[model samples]
Structure formats: structure tokens, C-alpha cells
Target chain A: MNPLPALAAAASEKATQSGPTLAVSDLRISAKRDRKSVELLRGVSFHVASGETLALVGESGCGKSITSLAVMGLLAPGLSMSGEVALTDAGGRIDLVALSAAERRKLCGRRLGMIFQEPMTSLNPMQRVGDQIAETLTTHGICSRQEAARRAVAMLDRMGIADPGRRALALPHELSGGMRQRVMIAMAMIGEPDLLIADEPTTALDVTVQAQILELIRDLSRERGMATLFISHDLAVVADIADRVAVMYAGEIVETGPIDQVLDAPLHPYTIGLIASRPALSTERRARLSAIFGAVPEPGRRPQGCAFHPRCSLAKPGLCDVGDVPLKRFDGRDVRCLRVGERVQA
Target chain B: MSIANVTSTSDRAPEKVPDARWLGLLKGLWRHRLGRAGCIVLAVLVLVAAGADWLAPHDPTEIYYDYILVAPDSRFWFGTDELGRDIFSRVLFGARVSLQVVAAAVALSLVIGAAVGLISGYAGAWIDNGLMRVMDGLMAFPALVLALAIVAVLGPDLLNAMIAIAVVNTPGFARLVRGETLVVRELDYVQAARAMGASPLRIVARHVWPSVSGNVLVYGSLKASAALITESALSFLGLGVQPPTPSWGYMLATGMQYTQAWWMSIFPGLAIFLTVLGLNLIGDAARDVIDPRTQR
Candidate 1:
């Protein structure tokens, strides 16, 4: 028997459906190894409203991907999460963290969908691309197999893939990297979810394909009025796609604001460093790109107080290293730094 | 308009076309010299076995007193045995028997082993440990001895012999599938499938199964050759196929006593050798064809 409709209905009945499509509040994930506890994500909070795009930007190992996985309820075993991950939609409000794995799964690919970073390896090599997309529909008991097949082809066409019917018969390996990512997009969007979490969806593609993919994602999200939680390490890519951007460093978000504000007038020291390191078309020839001094600290070995203090060019020894730097709200942004007003260039 | 075009394009001919990938595999197999030879030899053997009823000159069990112990000649072909039965006819029938046992034993082991391995690997942690330990226990005994013990318990018969060989070979397939499944279950596609709300069962069937099927098919072909040897050993020991059924193993066993005749042992041994060679060659060729790195 089909269980999704009833299950989703039951979940949506618990709370009012008025807030953001996804609201992750104070979500923390930690694990214990050899009697030592390592907190992977320390009290992270964010929200993505309908038709809005929120980019989670960070360097590698800064808990950006882990945050996305946490929201999907797909964290690796041994990592435990706490706090509210409320998902509100037409169905109703449901705390994803509160639901059992089985219940969370029922909501996935139905109310929420996700695309991954590596388009090359993200699709099943053995399955036809069309069948793979159709499977998402069938898994949620959304339609019959034949209908799913027809819709799959239609979705492929909508993704700007040429000859949708013929391409549908092609296996993942037979498709190009751009085509495969498009297939992934088709698969994710076919469910017409309220929220779509894309984890570095264009990191593996060339510049041309990356632009195309970003445009496709932007257009589709806008058309569907879908909330998008886009994760990426490239400030340039995030600039073109994200409405708002959250910068994470060593498991904590140091700055978050509307994209234009954060890009034009960044507040946090880490965010400033990221923007300085970025290469722009207008940069003078052979001018050296600025870089943040230190790598993102490992989760287990993160520095006490402010995690970014070690790498911050604006760091003051006594003030930055000895106290917790809370995420403070100003006029248009939240900056997690003790010296938010300082004009020191990274 | 595009949606209608797509719907109509699919509706025009909804039937599935033959997969080009399979056609390419066959072409690749034909290009490999040893693979081609193996295919030809197995095809001939299968034809010989299938047409045994019309092809055999005389009843395999018929006793001709005048022709008893005759050497190779025009009338009796590979000549007559001590019991005056045609050796050629018996060998042909033995081919049929050996192929049947190999098919049954391999299929049975593959089903059980693949299922066990998939479940054990996909449901990791304690279940993986427990199931693998059991498989290790089964593999501890020498294969032939294990088959012998199984035959002893189940009683001496063709079906029991197949069962014995299957049980003896189950651990090999289980280990291979478990190893492949372990790698496959961690791939990005599998993780993507999970994010798409695919359950454990669906993920295993759709993602893990296809990824590992090539390895399983190659392994199964290799196992068939081993199963052939085991089936012969069981029948040679008089625990399989029974007398008067004209099994190659039994013929070889009985023929060993007639050292002077020589043809008795020579012909049956040739059949086993050729069949095993064909299966091994096919297995090697299949491995080359199915592996992407090996493809041109």
C-alpha cells in the first residue's frame, strides 16, 4: 500500500505552515572517538523561505556539507544531532530531527529534494537516466511507472536536454557531466518539492556548464516557488545564485546577510578574507590574489573561543582569543566577531 | 507542445528496444580470441548434448556380446567397453549430465550466496560480522570434503550431488558479492538514492544489484568450472547420477580399471577437460569485457 500521502498528511497536521520552508535552529552534531567528543557542527542556525536561495559558503571541512546532510537526515552513523529542524510547507509543519528515520525518509523526495556536488558520480551508472528520474516518483508512490516515465521525459526536456525521449534511454555513463547534472536536477525537481538542497551542484563542471546549471537551478526554483539551500565554497558562484549567504568556519557561521550586502560590504573577518581571495574579471594582470592565512581548523582541534581567531587578520590577542564571539545582529547582517567595525583588509 | 511531443514520441513505440550495451558486450567477447574459441567449443558441446538422442549410434546401456572390449573401429567409433556399451554414446550422454549438474549447482549457489552477501554487506555492523563469520566457518573445510559430507548426509543421488556442490561453493560467491556490495553501497549514486527516499531494499535491488551483477556473472562462470570438477568427483566416488545413467565421472571411474583399453579413460577425460577449458576461457573473457578499464 502507498504510505506517503497519509504519512505526509499526518506530519503536516502537527504545526502551522506559516514560517520558512526550512528552519534549522541551533542544530549541533557531535561524535565520540576514543573517549573524546568532537563537535562537528556547533549550534548552527539558518532558514530558507519559499522561492528564496540561501547559500551555505565555507572552505572544505567547515561543516557546510555536514549541515546539508544533517537537514536531509543522512548523516553518517556515529554522528548524533540535536535541536529543531522544522520544515513547514502546504502539508504542515514537521520537525525533521524529531521524526524517526523511516518517517523522515517518507518526507524526502516528496516535500524535499537534493542534488549533490559530484555530477559525474552522483547518478546510478547502471540505470537509464530516465528510469533514474522516474524512480524518484515511484519511490514516493507519486504515480504509476508508465506515468512516471512520461513525466521523466518531460522533465528532461524541461532541464534543456535535447531529444528527451532518446536521452532517457541513455545510461549515466553515456551522458556528459553537464547532462548528468541536468539529469540529477530533473530527478530532484520532478517531485516538485517545497525545498531543494543543492550541495555544490556545479563544483565539478567547467565554467560554461556551471553557468548553465546555476541558471537552470535559479529559474526552476523561482518558477516552482521552491526554497533552495545552496552549499558551495566558491564565493563567485554563490554571488550569482544565492539571495542570502551564510559563511561557515570550523562548524560555526560567522556571517550571514543578503548576498549584495555581504559581497559589497562584508563584516566578519573570515568573510572579508574569502572575498579578498576571490579572483575577479576586473583584477589587474598578475596581481597576487590575497589569501586567508590559516586553514579551517579540524573539528577535534578547533581553537577555543572564536574558531576563526587564528586566521583573522584583525585578531587582537587578548580580546579575540579569550572570549566567545557571538553572532551579533546589526542593521542588515549578523557578524560573529568581537571587532565587527574594524576596517582591516584581509 | 514539448510535453505533448515527448509523450507522443514515447507513445509511438513504448516497447523497450534491445540494449546496445549487451550487443557491444557480445561483440567484445567475439573479438577476444580465447573467448571466441570458448564460445564455439561450448556451443558445439551444447549441441552435441541437445542432439544426443538422435546422434548416439546405439543405446548407451545396450550390451553386444560380440563387440565387447573392441578397440576403436568404424562400427563402434570410440570402441566398446567391457560391458559392450558404446563408449562414444556414453560420453555424449555424460556431457548432457555434466552440463545439467553444472547449471543447477551454479544457479542454486548464486541465488543463495548473492542474497546472503547483499543482506550481510548492506546491513553492516553486527549483522555483517555475524554473517561473515558463518561464511568463514563454511569455508574452513576443504571444498571436496565439505561436498562429500553433504552428500553423505543427503544420500547419494544426482540432485543431492548438485546440492552438495552448491553448498560447498556458496561461500566463495558469498564472499565475492559481499566484497562488491561493500564498495557499491558507499558510492555517490547509492547515497543519492538514499537521499531520494529509496529504502534499504530498493537501494540494494536497484543500485547495488546492477553494480555487482558483472562481478557475479564472471565469478559464476569461474565457479561453474569448479562445480564441474566437484560433480565428477562425487559421481566418480559413486555418490552421484547412479549406475546405468552413463555419467562421465562414473565412466572414468569404471574405465580406470581397463588400463589396456585406454580409450575408456581417454574420451571421458577429454570431455571434462574441454568443458572446463571452455568455462575458464569464457570467465576470463567476460572479466575483460565487463571491466570498463579494460574496454578500448
Candidate 2:
């Protein structure tokens, strides 16, 4: 069964028909200069069923952040985007790509919330932590200042921040790195958005704080029934929280499947390489960890045929160098490789 | 729900423990000797400017012919200028003009420069390139020469001189603010604000602006001293406050005609020098205090 069609049909057939909370199809994004344009996201497509979590995993410059920014309509001015981001809910299915900036802003922070990567620099240094969170609540017309403050305090408490009442008045600088991350989570969840985009949410945090933040995100997401697009470079983190995972390389998705399947048996060579590269506990202390040779292909100068051919250890002598391999279904998973047809088992 | 309730109870125990950093910053500022001195000086200057009339011993412009160019005496510690005007009275009144022009000019430049800089730095691409190019063109001209040209165009007066000085100073501030804004805009907080769905205006106002304001203020204070010097230059050239007004610059200009009357020019020039020197010292101290990277 094709997951796309099944999900789409399921989304349409529901009596409530609140539509797919966030959907992007064949989305393409590029950054342009005077005479050159570098494609950052090429034909990437995904959807988040209402209250489900979808993770986009990739290394730096793999277009994860760009994809999230595209969803938020917050791409920098030099970059041009062409795609469809459709959002449907109690209001109706509206194409987000075509909306005016003002209209998009109205939907943002209210219907769609985002948790950024770094907590240290993500907050206003001069403003109190409570005011920053309150600003979100008030901007979207969700609650009054008094109500927002009360809610902010509660949200902070829920995130395991100590002394929510007192800490609410503190500036961002006054808080520890972990506390700041909690404040960020609280601010994002205050509006109770239908969809939440957490881009590298735990990347900048300590291991303990990272675990706490991830747990808080999971618990809160479950409670609110919020559809989330979790973007991260760490495969381990994604495996823990993501319902489904999309592995990206350069600017395209190489493989996607349920988290367990993707983690246990990856189809794409890049995914296999990634899993092999990690330092597993079963490996001996003196063993040299496996690493994928060669960097990800540059955006503008990507090699002909397969973009990963230059780095794939299992690349067929002639087949990998000749033509582009479109994403195809294999063992109920999406894999883009000429070798997918071969009889190989993990 | 019961688990959450239990967690809340556990969380409440930590509420009594206070964060030491918040209290430390306040105490640190209070104990900083230079910062305290700078604050006191700024406050006194503000108060003196506010009550110039009550502070002056005599009419600033009244010509005392009987005591023409008198040396420092019991009645007139600062002596008299070439016009026989009490130099002490004129200097006190001159504080009102000097401080007012500096304050007003600095404010105007800050508003104009900050807006331009924030937009240029935050919104990169052709917009940033274009704004920077324009700023470069303005900066290419010498500061004093640009001010002189502006004064020449608008015609000479103290207010016009201030306006000219402000225009000349604007590019420096714009460049400074733009550079800082670029760095601050890339900060995680700015990215967080954007993710939170803050409009460009709101992000700049809340996230970007506050981070850069401290730096801008230090630059503005330094520029105010430059503006004071510029105003004096224009006045000495007969392009600022006219005669019978008793401006420090005017007194210096009048003293030039009297080769033997050294007291006339010396006192006023010294006042101008000391004021600028004090402002520069304070600006340096402010830079050290506000910028964490510079603080030891």
C-alpha cells in the first residue's frame, strides 16, 4: 500500500475532516545570487497527520532547517521557493504558499508553533522570560496579559522549570542553559498550536537537559495531540521520538519509513552508512568505527545520475554513474537506489 | 494526573532556592567604582542643564565694561571675556546650549541610523549591499568637511550647525549599528523569535534592538562630544551662535582679536576641552561595562 495515498484518503474520509494539519508536496527551495542559484531542497515531500510526529533527519546543510523554514514561510529573502504547503483544520484547507505575509503571520504562533535549536540565543536578552512567552500569547489574540502570564507560569512549571513564578520575571541571561531551553519549550507550547516544528531542539543542550527536553516534548505532544515536524541531525534522537523518519542527503530524501524499521534495517546506502558510522555498544573498544567516505555533494555541482554515487560503498560500477534513481517502494519503505531491486536482506 | 500532581509537589521544593546570578549583577553594578562615578557625573550634568537659569551668577551676555577682561577674582572666579561678560555665567549658560545640542543631535542620529542599520544588516542581499554602499559614499567625505558643507547649504545658525553635525555623525552610527545588528540577528534568540512567529518589526524591536542598544548608546555619547566640538568650530567661524549671545565659541572668536587678552580664549577653550574629555572617558567606561566580551 502506498502510504501517501492511504494517508491522503484517510485525511479526506474523516467526518471531522480537519484535513492534514501540514502537507508539503514536491517542495523545492533554492538560494540565488547575482547570477547563480543553489538548490537547497529538491522535490522534498511529506505530511504530518493531525497529532502525529514526523522527523526529518539529515546532517548539516542537508536541507532540514530550510525545509522547516519553508513550512514557516520564514526563508531568507535571497532564497526563492516554489512549492505547495497546504494546511487544513476547522477553518478549511488553504494553500500556505500563496498566502500574503500578513495572512501567514496570523496562522503562525496561533495554529502552527515552532521550537528553535539553541536556547541560549533564542530568547530576548533584555526582556523577561515571562514577557517573551506572553508576547506570543498576546500576539495571536489567544489570551490577555494577565492570563498569558498565568499560563506562562503553568507552562514553565509543566516543563520542569524550578520556581516558575519567580523565574518568570527573570531575563534569559539569568537562566541556566537547561532552564532557557525549558523556557523556549514553554513559549512554543503556550499557544497550543495544531502543528509544532521542533528544529534541532536538543542539539545545543547537555545530555541530561536533552533527555528532559525530549521527554517534555513527547509528553506535551501526546497531551495536546499536536502534529509535530521534528528536524534534527542526530539519528539517535530521532529514533527515540519520531513516529516516522525521513533521511535526507544534500537536498533530497533518500529513505523514509517507520522509526523502528528505518533504525533496524535501512534500505538506502546512505542510511546504512549512517547507522554503521555510529559507535554502538556492541562494538569493541579498539574497533575503528565505519565512516562514509567523501562529503555530501555540493548543491550546485551535484554529480550526474545519483547524487550519493560518489560516496556509496556499494555503488554498481556503471549503473550508479549513469542515471538518476527515483524513489521507489521496497519492503514497505521508500528507498532511492538502483540496488533496491537486488535480493539482499539485513 | 496524579503523577503530574506528584511532580508538581516535587518541583515546589526547589522554589525556595534563589538564583545567585541575578542578585550578583545588581551588586556588581553598585560596587563598580567607575560606573558609579560615571552615573553621578551624568546625573549632575543633567540637573545642571535643567536648571541653568538658577545656576548662573549673572546674565550670561551682560557686558560689564568696568571689569573688561578681568583676571580670576573673588566675584568672577573664571574672570571676564573680551566683551567684559562674566565668563563663569556664560560657561554655565553655555552648558545648556552645548548639552541640549548634543542630546538632540545624538537622539536624531540614533533614530535615523538605527533604523537604516537594522534594516541593512538584518535584511541581507541587495538591500544590505545597497545601504552599505550609500553609507560608504557618505563616509568617504571627511566628517568635519561634510558638516561644513551642510552648514554652508542650510546657512549658519546654532540649530542649523547642530543639524549639520548630526547629519555628519549619522553614517558612523549607521555603520556601527548595522555591523552589530548583523551579528545579533544571527543569534539563537533572533532565530527563536522568528520561529515564534514574530513579525520582522517585532523581532527587530524585541530581540535585535535591545541587544544593540547598549552599543549604540556608547557610540552616541562619544558622538555627542564630537558634535560639541563641531558646534564650537561653527561658532568660532561666525556660523553658529551670533555675537551678544556669549557662546564659548563666540568668546574664543572675540578673544582672537585681542592678542594680549589671553584669558578670554583660554578659559572657554579649556571648558570645551574638559567637557569632551570627560565624555570620552565615560564612553570608554560604558563600552567596558556593557560589552561582556570586553569586560575582564
Candidate 3:
């Protein structure tokens, strides 16, 4: 058995015996527009064993961010959702998708926390950064204003924010992009939630800041023993952070397995294409950077059968065009491809 | 992790505090010549209106038959009206009436309209459509004409006039607030608040309302000026503040009957014109100062 899968299986077994921190199964989301409904997420499923980081990696419009939003119950109006987003917190297992908006709100910030993409825009401009953090604490009834403010400052200090007391009073605009993102992290982690969803958290920051924020997330997740759902478009970034990686294409997860296996021996063509497209400094100078041909298919115009058939290099002309391939497990990895089980020598 | 970390950490000790932009904005208004002048004029008018009872040398309604139509003098400053009432004293008192009506009407309109607009704009869907359609229907009627119609129905009285002016101004304030609410509702902070598990009401109160207040406040000031003019117009038409009471518009109306008597018309007309002009200037300045987009 491969070491990565063995590690993942061991982790899963450990979590199964101890209980999962969060489990989302068969989560589907559809959006309606102009009297027509479009499926945004089609039976997407994943779970985060306690203290494990699960990365949902895909190009933009592949529903990676949508999955995080769905998990958080932050989907916008006109979108219909189904399936279970279950959390096994101290309160016991509860289906988040079935909860009322108020009940969902109660869970949010208390049990399930989120750090958004753009820290600059995600924070209220008129409010002081400290007050914003305090608001989260007070909203969840975790503490009084005075206690929340005190905790907020301490949290900011812990997040490596300089002069936490004074910086607390500063507006989001006053802080640097990195500092603002740090404040966002501080706010999200203030409650020490069981599940923390970081939706493209480092996408807007500089490379140095991105590394810092990623390290911060990693360190904090480990310290709190929280299950992290880290969503990102950069496969390289996810490779370092995720224990398991779920590669999505056309709103469906095309492959999901241990990060090392998915990166080293990707079974799905989409995953292979994504992996190969990463520019490598170690490769030959004459080797052109591989790129997936064509943009992501528009939601309503997604192709039938295998969604990646149009762009798949290994596609069989007749078979790939004819039948939809359901995700099937092979060697402990789930791949949605017809040739995964077949021994076709490349 | 080294001495570089220690010095780097020390370098972070007291980052310069960014200047408060809103406070800077207020300072800009204070420095602006036109805005300052406007503010001074408004302050003087407000003081005069507030202290009218103590400032007026004579009871505005108390008449002196022998001194009727007397020209400007040390005793009867702006002169006397046809009824031998001190026009200066009456004009001072008229400032009180006009100012009171404007303040009351604007306050009432802002409270009612802002609540309605916030509900309509934020709630959206059928609630937005229904409330906005009603506002549109109300706005279709000319502001002054609507006030006149309402006053006529309610029977001409000071309270009726104030209520009429407030009712007429309500839709304008509602529309202004609703437009602002719609714009503010889409702001990222509002969306963030919503995503952070804030209820719709909490989002509106904490995130939406604060941002929209500056716009609403500036517009509300302008609306007060409009209400003032409308109240004056109603009084000028003999449909507002009865004859015995001191009203700038009433004074102007009665004063104009005697075309030969210039002081009769000039003093009250000038008072009304200056007050309205001062309010408009202040309102214009406020709009520029509160909205950064308008700043040069």
C-alpha cells in the first residue's frame, strides 16, 4: 500500500473510531436564472477528519468556493441546496443544511467559522477592526462586549499583529493587506470553532504574505485541533497544505485522494492536466508550460457524459462521448473516468 | 527568530496612526469660506429663532394705531405694518414659526421616510416594489400642491400646515433614503456582515444604516429647506399660520397689499430669502463634505 493512502486510511480509521469533526455528504446546489435551473454542484461530497486539512482544489468556476460557501450556508438567494452538511461538535451530530437560517447563524461563528477571500472588502469599513472581531464574539453570545474586546485584542496579539490594542481601533483600510487578512484569521479563530472554512484565503495576498497566512492557518489549525476546509485554485499551494485533495471540474469532483497520490499519479485527465500545467523551474528550458485547452465550460452549457471529454488528452472518442462516468474507487482513490480500472499502457 | 526579529518587532512598536478621514472632512468644511459663511448665517438665524421672545422689543401681535405704517426708526427698527404692529418684532417671531415648522416637519419626515425606505430597499422583492410604488404615487403630486391639498382638507391651522408640509416631504425623503439603501445594501461590508451570520435586521442596523446615514442626513437638511419654503408659500397663500400670528409669509402677503410701503414687504421678504439661502448654502456644503466622491 502507498504510504500516503496508508496514512490517510489510518487517519480516517482513527477519526471513524473517535468521530469525525465535520462530514458533508452528497452536497448538491442548483441556481435558477431566467426560468431555467443550472446545477452548480452535482453530488459533491467530502469529509474532514478531526485535525486534518482537506483541500478542495479547482480552477475558478469549478465550484470549489461554492462548496465552501455551501458548507457555511452562505449561498446567495435563488440557489437551491440539498444533501447533508453534518457537524459532530460537542452538541452532537446536526445536519447544517436542514437548520433554519437563525439556527445556522447560531452555528456559524460558534461551531463553524469562515475566513473570506478578500480581507479588505470582507471587513466593515466603518467599524474598527477590533470591534469587528468583538462583534463576532458577541454575536455568538460567547462573551460580553468587554470580554469580547479583551479577547479580540489578545487574539490579535496571538495572530502576530503588532500593537494589538491600538490596531484594534484601526479601520480595515488603515491596515496593510497582509495585516487585514491576519485580522480576519484572528476573528475567525477567536471562537475556536470545530470546523474552519478558509475560502481562497490567500488568493488576494502577495506571495510572501500568502506563505505567512498559510503557515498561520496551518499552525492555528494544529493548535486548535480543528478540521480545516482550505479551498484554493493553486494546486501547488494545496499540495503543501492538504492531507487529501479533491480535484473538481465542471462543478463535480473528478478525483479525490491523498494529496501526494493525486499529485504524483493523477487518475482523472482533468487532474492530470491541472497537475501538468503547473510551471516547473526544474524542468528543461525548452519545455513549454503545459496548459489545459479551453476555458471552463459555462454552467448551463456543461457537456453531457464526461464533463472533461472535450479537453481530456486521454479521452476515447466513442466511449468518452457516450456514457457518464460515475466516480469509482480504485486503489483507495475515487476517480470519475472510464479508463481508471482498465490497464491501458500509455 | 534572531536579532533581526527583535529589531523588526521593535520597528513595529508604534506605527503612525492614519488620520481620521471623517474628522479631516469636517475640518475641510470648517476651512471652506463659503461653507463657513453659510454656517455662520445659519447659526445666527437659528439663534434669532430660538431667542425670538427675549429679543423682540415689542409683543409681535400687540398693535399701536397711531404708529401704523411708520418707517424704520430706532424704536420700530424695520418699521410698522398697516396694523401698527412692529414688523421687526413680528419678523423675529416669524423666524421662530418658520424655523419650528421646518425642524418639526423635517424631523418627522426623516423618521418616517428613513424607516420606510430602509425596510423597502433592504427587504426587496414585493416589499420593495410595494413601498416604492406607493412612494412613486405620492411623489407624482407636486410637493407644494400636495401640501396645499392636505392643508385644505385638514382645515388651515399651524399644526395642519406643519403636518401637510411633512406629509408632502415624506416621499422625497423616502425616495432619497431608498436609493441610498439600495446602493449601500450591495456594499461588501454588508455582504460580509450577512456572511458572518448577522441577521438581516442586524446587518441593516450595524452595517447598512451607518454608511447610509451621511447621505440621508445631507438630503434631510436639503429637505428641511424645501419644507421651510413650502411652509412659507402656504402662509403666503393665506392658508397657513393665521393673520394674527406672526409668520414671515403672512407678513409678506399683507405687506405686498400696500405696494407703496416698501419696508412692509422688503423686511419680511429679505428675512425669508436670507434664511432659505443660508439653509441651501449649508445643505450644499454638507453634501460636498459628507460624500468623499464630491471632494476635489
Native A-B interface contacts kept, per candidate = 0.48, 0.46, 0.36
Model 2 agreement with the true structure over B85-134: per-residue lDDT tens digits: 88888877777777777788888888889988999988888998998888
Better of 2 and 3 by TM-score: 3
lDDT of 3 by residue, A221-272 (tens): 8788888999999886887788888899988999988888788898888888
A129-152 in candidate 1: lDDT tens per residue? Answer: 899999999998989999999999
* TM-score result, candidate 1: 0.91
- lDDT, model 2, position A122: 80
Residue B140, candidate 1: how far off, in angstroms?
Answer: 0.9
Regions of model 3 farther than 4 Å from truth:
A1-7, A10-18, A282-287, A343-345, B1-26
- Cα-based lDDT at residue A217, candidate 2: 92
TM-score of each candidate's B chain against the true B chain: 0.91, 0.85, 0.90
lDDT of 1 at A173: 61
Q: Chain B in candidate 3 has what TM-score? A: 0.90
Tell me the interface RMSD of model 2, in angstroms: 6.9
Candidate 1 chain B has its poorest 10 consecutive residues by lDDT at B9-18
| DockQ result, candidate 2 | 0.36
Which candidate ranks first by TM-score, i.e. highest? 3
Q: What is the lDDT for B215 in model 1?
A: 80
